[model samples]
Target chain A: MTVSDPTVGELSEGEILARILARLSPSRALLGPGDDAAVIAAPSGRFVATVDTLVHGPDFRLAWSNGFDLGWKAAAVNLADVAAMGARPTALLVALAMPDATRASFVEHIADGLRAACEALAPGCAVEGGDLTVSDTLVVAVTALGVLDAAAVTRSGARPGDIIAIAGDTGVAARGLDLLFSHFTDASGTPIAISPAALRSLSDEDGTALSRQLRPFPPVALGPAAASAGASAMMDVSDGLVLDASRMAVASTVTLDFDRQCVGDDPLSLSGGEDHALLATFPPSAVLPEGFRAVGAVRDVGAAPVTIDGEPYDGESGWDPYRDWDSARG
Target chain B: MTVSDPTVGELSEGEILARILARLSPSRALLGPGDDAAVIAAPSGRFVATVDTLVHGPDFRLAWSNGFDLGWKAAAVNLADVAAMGARPTALLVALAMPDATRASFVEHIADGLRAACEALAPGCAVEGGDLTVSDTLVVAVTALGVLDAAAVTRSGARPGDIIAIAGDTGVAARGLDLLFSHFTDASGTPIAISPAALRSLSDEDGTALSRQLRPFPPVALGPAAASAGASAMMDVSDGLVLDASRMAVASTVTLDFDRQCVGDDPLSLSGGEDHALLATFPPSAVLPEGFRAVGAVRDVGAAPVTIDGEPYDGESGWDPYRDWDSARG
Candidate 1:
């Protein structure tokens, strides 16, 4: 007999999953679990992967962040990692924990979010499998898989005199957060509540920004473009552009001097975290490829830290999750 | 300037991950991201995937469930999913959420857990990428990827007259819980301060059980073995053999009669979760696979519920995560 309770569902996640998985076929490369360690075929000999987690209050709010967004972002963040690596995303798996009473709709919405994100970010990257359970608070975690065909770009490949270019905009997510935080009071300061209209507008912006934050729009196609175009070093802009670009420099053991003016003033183009843009360094001899905008150039490594417009900033370096919780509050 | 605190780390999980991903390589199959939708080449044209979530209290204990186990189990559970599909595990990604004060060691331990499980289960499967965040409690979500070489075994292929068999033992984890609850108190309900040595023994058993419970050793190799051996249908015994097997029977439109005598009386053989064993069905004419033993046969679906030796079970059918919780405390 099938027993169903609003509090307790008839099928445990594992049981339901077994039934669902029964429909899929196994691969020769898949080695182990369906029974043990699944043996996967890595003809290229190496596979690409990335992971990300989201917590309640800090990463998302139940009131503002729906389950769909939760699922969407979870997958998005991980897929972006594969994109940064210049790999094609193949499949995705998710792990979720929440309170027992969490509405089934919420869980389904989470799936919907995953579906939506997969539809937009990694088509055919099936939500092949995942785990679900109850927790004190809601948590969503996603891991993404990618495949590299031939040339995989690395941050260390950049050389001096290589031009730095970006595949997409930046900072829109940070701006979206700025708009979001305008509504909520933070530990840094006590702010008054805004009207519903303003809140809604900010939320709408937040949705786009949050979508960027939650389901980052990564330049998955750009990795290969940069590789074929003879780009020296490449990486996705996950952190602030300035901070992430500096990372490329540090990894390559070179100094990267970026022109602040060269980076357009769009907030999304500045400090956003959700815009999965590819920033790469290429030989000056190579013309900046189409769909990529020139940002700056690589230089020799030095004792001094990364500088924008030849000046060091005394303010916040970039977005930090713990230190900058207030920034995401809106 | 960068501000770092033990309680509050320097960068958000996203920022740190972004910086790390910059160093990785990309492939040709990746379509788009850093923009939208990564294009991955599924050479076989199909992907194998699975996800599992771990909560702080229900799934594990912060004190006992060390970081390595947490990480290992997170990946192991999903790997089990792939194994169940008769696929080979390729890559894995993790998403973790925990409190801000969480020691770096704890996170590092979790990574160690992931590494250990991967090594034990699938050597080729590496952690691709994941996200971590601060939360009120710890939550870990992992997604595992697998590649299928041939057709995947599903739960729906069983037919009437097919014998059922299960790999691996069960109930060890459930008995481990019994030991845990009973050790602190005698059977008569008397409080007892157990000696550390006794506690260690219990802990050791718990470790074994928890390993079974947390990181189930799925018999991934058996997926293809069953298929090659002419097994009609197969699935992982996740919730319980009875419940999951019943599901297979119903999906295949058949009634399966299980010989209770065929099921060993070992506590580890009954009502256990996380054995990660593949329970499969084969026609009477088909020889039992090398790793498999016959437990029952499929019959016509009827009004009477699944029976053990032609007798209905008036007692508990099997374990259900939500239903079993009320009695789980014991």
Candidate 2:
């Protein structure tokens, strides 16, 4: 809208990339961004890699999230996946597809958010290489790579007597999502910005929930700590505690039972998503890591993969991208 | 269309993933798709990584390309970047964002295409991990990782006297694109399928051009071979010889002078894009790699980064996603 901030359509790819590189932290890779491909040191002789994508309509609404929050959340989610494998993230490759009409400043903000998230949540992790292309939709696809200091803590290693634990906030992001749907949309379900008066009047819990939804800061450092302390199975809780736990249980050929009191008997706590909490199973005699707290215990193969208080309690099963996305509302 | 081939929206994410995995090659990484992230071997202590994305509208037209072609092109483009670094691609992380109504069978074909490209171009590379999300527009974002046995080749390492060469076709794919625009579109410029009669009537060169555009099979293994043969600098020619050579020249602080006859005097050969050719500079005394052919030579920094027979040549400069995309046309 201003003379200084041009739409991307007015510039060249080189100019936009230069602008982005200027905002990012200096590369610490063996070879960095100016080249066709970046070379990163794989110190452990192996590297953990994963990719996650954030699409404009289905993942977030511009009314609720700014460029900064979107970028930070994107990096946080993928970094959590790497952390869940007991690795310290070292590099990121970001592929961004945006409409040509998008502003250069907005893109710079996204770059800043990526750098900030890496510095605050996963130290020494910097974006090493990336691609930019024009698209009808705005998409951020990030690949996070890490070097493991210990054996990867997979979801298939749990035993019958292991204690199930969780690190970082659970259900809070779901509640934040709940508030947005309840208060931030118009009658036809179009998102509108949260009003200043409403922001001022929200409860402390509501404020925290809203913040969690917009910019989740998962406990990244505790993953390796849990692994070092002898976690048998581990995974990030993105699709709610129950849904992700069932996956772990199925992989391990065991049953997972959570105490209703410890996991918060609320449906959202059991089925909420986007929290990026690290969930792990530790042996009976193991001391829980500093950020982890025992929430339940693993059991022998039962009728169901997950149970609550000795029963097959059911609520929302959390997000299944194909089943949950309502294009009309999105 | 049938009970066995339901739309992806009718299935859970797990079901869709299982279907895709079944269509892909067996996993070769230390850990694969079932985990939070995959662990891949980095035998050389260094890994090359890069990401590229193709969006439906600006990147391709469904009427013109099927799911298989889409997947193959995505993998081929990213693989070329890794090869350009003088490394052998080992793994790919694919992030696919598609419409909810997309058919499950279509997704499977995409997986098959990805597998086929990797198998043909880089024998050991496989899809190790990926993310699937729902979007209004179809986007395929691929991240490729590789290991280097020789010192990683970079575009900045080219010397003034180095010989410039290319290992793949330049203007052929561009001609393929031109043909589609000229013959495959309706009066209003909307893409329509290539008619059977039109397909049957095409000449051999035109047919090859069409195939090149749809499913590019870049010289993946030759990148390392070029390096082994003492290539001083290397990069993939995605955006055309003139434009990409200009980049290498700038990065090396040198100028590139091309023999128009060797590189083809056609403007498209110099300015068109999406070729995925391996372009490199080698010591004048070094024997050219098997697949490579001399096209130019590096010179001291001159008025223009790129020249034709020692003179500044002007034509189309090649694609700048930000500047070239016409949203209305897309």
- The sequence of per-residue lDDT tens digits that candidate 1 reaches over residues A1-330 is 975434324456565445434433232233322432233344564556566677777777665566766777777767766676667766665566666676655676677777667677766565544556767787777666666766667777888778888887688767655665555545664443444675566556565764565456676666666777887777777667866776777778888777878875454555566676888888998977788988777878876445566554334445567666643333
What is the per-residue lDDT of model 1 for residues B132-195, given as tens digits with 9 covering 90 to 100?
6778878777666666666767777888777888766567656655555555566764335445
- The model with the greatest DockQ is 2
- lDDT for each residue of candidate 2 in B261-320, tens digit (9 for 90 to 100): 897779888887888999899999999989999998999999999999998878886877
Candidate 2: TM-score, chain B only: 0.98
Q: Pairing residues by index, what is the TM-score of model 1?
A: 0.78
- After TM-score superposition, what is the CA distance of residue A203 in candidate 2 from its true location, in Å? 1.3
DockQ of each: 0.29, 0.89
Pairs in steric clash, model 2 = none
| Chain B TM-score of every predicted model | 0.80, 0.98
Docking class of 2: high
Question: What is the per-residue lDDT of model 2 for residues A215-267, given as tens digits with 9 covering 90 to 100?
Answer: 99889999888889999999999998899999999999999998988987888
Q: What TM-score does each of the candidates earn?
A: 0.78, 0.98
Q: Give candidate 1's error at residue A138 in angstroms.
A: 0.9
